[model samples]
Target: MAGSTKTKAKKPTVKKPSANKAAEASHNGAAHAFAPEPGDFRRYFDSGHTHESLGITPETLLDMYRNMLLQRRFEERAAQMYGRQKIAGFLHLYIGQEAVSVGSVWGTRPDDPIITAYRDHGLALARGMSPNAGMAELYGKIDGCSRGKGGSMHFFDVDKSFYGGHGIVGGQIPVGVGMAFAMKYKETGGCCLTYFGDGAINQGAFHEAANLASLYKLPVLLIVENNEYAMGTAVHRASAEPDLYKQAYAYDMKGAIVDGMDLFEVYHAMQELADEAREGKPALVEVRTYRYRGHSMSDPQKYRTKEELEAKKDEDPILRVKKYLLDNELATIEKLDDLDESVKAEVMAAVEFAENSPVPEIETMYEDIYTQSDYPFLV
Candidate 1:
């Protein structure tokens, strides 16, 4: 790590939200649109001032904007490395969905548990994991949080309480519920944020896990990141009802639709839900977000058109946050530019560390596949 000098799972019983109840509840909310009401969401596009009008402090807005920019830059760097062939395997970049992760993660305490799908680089960074450590994982270096075996999809750090970067589509759902159950059973003041994509909504696991969480009133937040596409397949083409938040009715829990592109809106929604979960109630949040990149690094995007992509770019979450900061004079252009440069340097440092760090020793591969290890496991 001389080049940079930078810092830094599990399958459980699977459950699905009950179909009969979900179906019944889904119909009840059908009469209402999932879009947030007038005051439910705060828009930054046309606003000259933020935080004050939104009842949040200038410090909070700056903090949220900084976090979102970090995520945006982190993913951008990951994509660049993937292009250079420095990173291998599947790479799911969270380019346009920064607000969802940054905002939601900010709402949780240091001791709270957070779990999500394979797109976890941003989540890790938001939870205080360094860019150097995350990039090192992508490069398969021993210094990675997982000792380099997990790559981009499995960056687990028990000390920080990030459960994992689960590779399976909906696999983390039940695990999130179980973590919540453990917290309740052991009387720990912790909750789990289980995140997955809209594509995974149809998975039987979601229905089952959701039902259990609600029935038990476990301290968990079921976050469905409705980014409109599941691996290049649009939701309209796949889902019967694209309003993902409506599924919450089946579990008899609270549900809300948040503007995933706006950090303020996402923060407000996540804060409220986290409170509900802590009070021994389960809830669901459908973050209506969009991913600027393909489902993964290799996607050619034949499924959609450039015009549509450009249109969505107009709603860039990072830009919205930045504009809000400037308009309110919370941060000046010089400060933001300095911040951008700092992040870029941080990312470059991480890449250098990953390129220079040692790969895991060959002999170590014989260890850690099971509860008990044998030397020949590598062979």
Candidate 2:
């Protein structure tokens, strides 16, 4: 048979699908595979809980309000700047999620390190980065933090222990763990507040970091700023376990969900979790928050409905704090109005400062690249 020039059967060639088609298939699979729970995620702190029981003074409350308001106004101005083409590149506004950053920051000690994903202006402001420097950074000015190299997504203040605003999704998870490991190694009594969006919870980096943190009992608080979406994709669509805090169960780490819209609740939850983290017990805290703005300046935002956004507006964290101040008779309307006006003026001044600041020099681009400078090429 072999010598008779027999026709061999040909094996079928399997053509791999296009990248777009493969992505579409993957998206469809994810969309269908996700199954969210019917009820809310289990939480440590309830909304509408009074901080008076915890002896949080009215002055502290006012400070919290001011911090949140400052962030809100700063972002509002940043958005305006983006509209005017003054602020270039990506601008991810942290409009409605102010309480999450402000409250969590206020709960932590001054020396505790903070690292978050982009959409980080609020966290930087909350961590005491100067509004002028932050705005200038957005403007790419020489006076800006990171010498204007970082822009909107990479705000860093080494003195304040504010690590960075990482642009890559979930990239800061392991970095934060490393920071926490350093804290534990040095016995600094300072924990790392590692923040990422609910979208990042699906990332393998998050799981690996969480596992390592739990395994080593590193002093790290993994905070998921569950703003419901990762860019355009909603939690229900992207995550198999949309209840993000429950993912901590896999590592047997303590976990809690908090009302991120309520500043008091966020502060309390962060305080508890951060304390535990500092005591060498890693924890996961999912702050259920929302963003009023689109993912970035360029986003068209077709993923979610207008009605859904409107519904979330009623729970605006800034508004909630304002209501709390008024309802408790802690501050008169005039005082609150004055505070708002002051914040607006401060934000405007920051914008002016950024406008006046000089741009970075081309020669300095190679500076701050590395700590050790004895390169063979330089020699």
Best by lDDT: 2
Question: How would you encode candidate 1's per-residue C-alpha lDDT over 1-379 as one tens digit per residue?
Answer: 5687644445677898555755766885644444544543222222232466557787777777777777787788888888889889988988999988888887677778989999888788888787778889999998888889999999887788887899999999998999999998988867788999998888999999999998887999999999989997889898988777777776666777888888777777777778778888777889899999888888899999999999999999999888878876789999999988887888889889999989999987976676533556643
- Model 2 residue 171 CA deviation in Å: 0.7
**Prediction-by-prediction clash tally:** 7, 0
TM-score of each: 0.84, 0.87
Q: Give candidate 2's TM-score.
A: 0.87
- Residue pairs clashing in model 1 are 15-208, 15-209, 16-207, 16-208, 16-209, 17-207, 17-208
Please report, in order, the local distance difference test score of every candidate based on alpha carbons. Answer: 0.82, 0.88
- Model 2 pairs whose backbones collide: none
- State the weakest 10-residue window (summed lDDT) of model 2: 31-40
lDDT per residue for candidate 2 within 1-379, as digits (tens), equals 6579767999999997555755766774532213434331347556557768656899988988999999999998899998999989989999999999888888779888999998899999998999999999999999999899999999999999999999989999999999999889999999999999888888899999999998899999999999988888889998888888888777767778888998888888888788888887888888899999999988899998999999999999999889989999999999999999999999999999999999989987988787656876774
Displacement of residue 52 (Cα, Å) in model 2 is 1.5
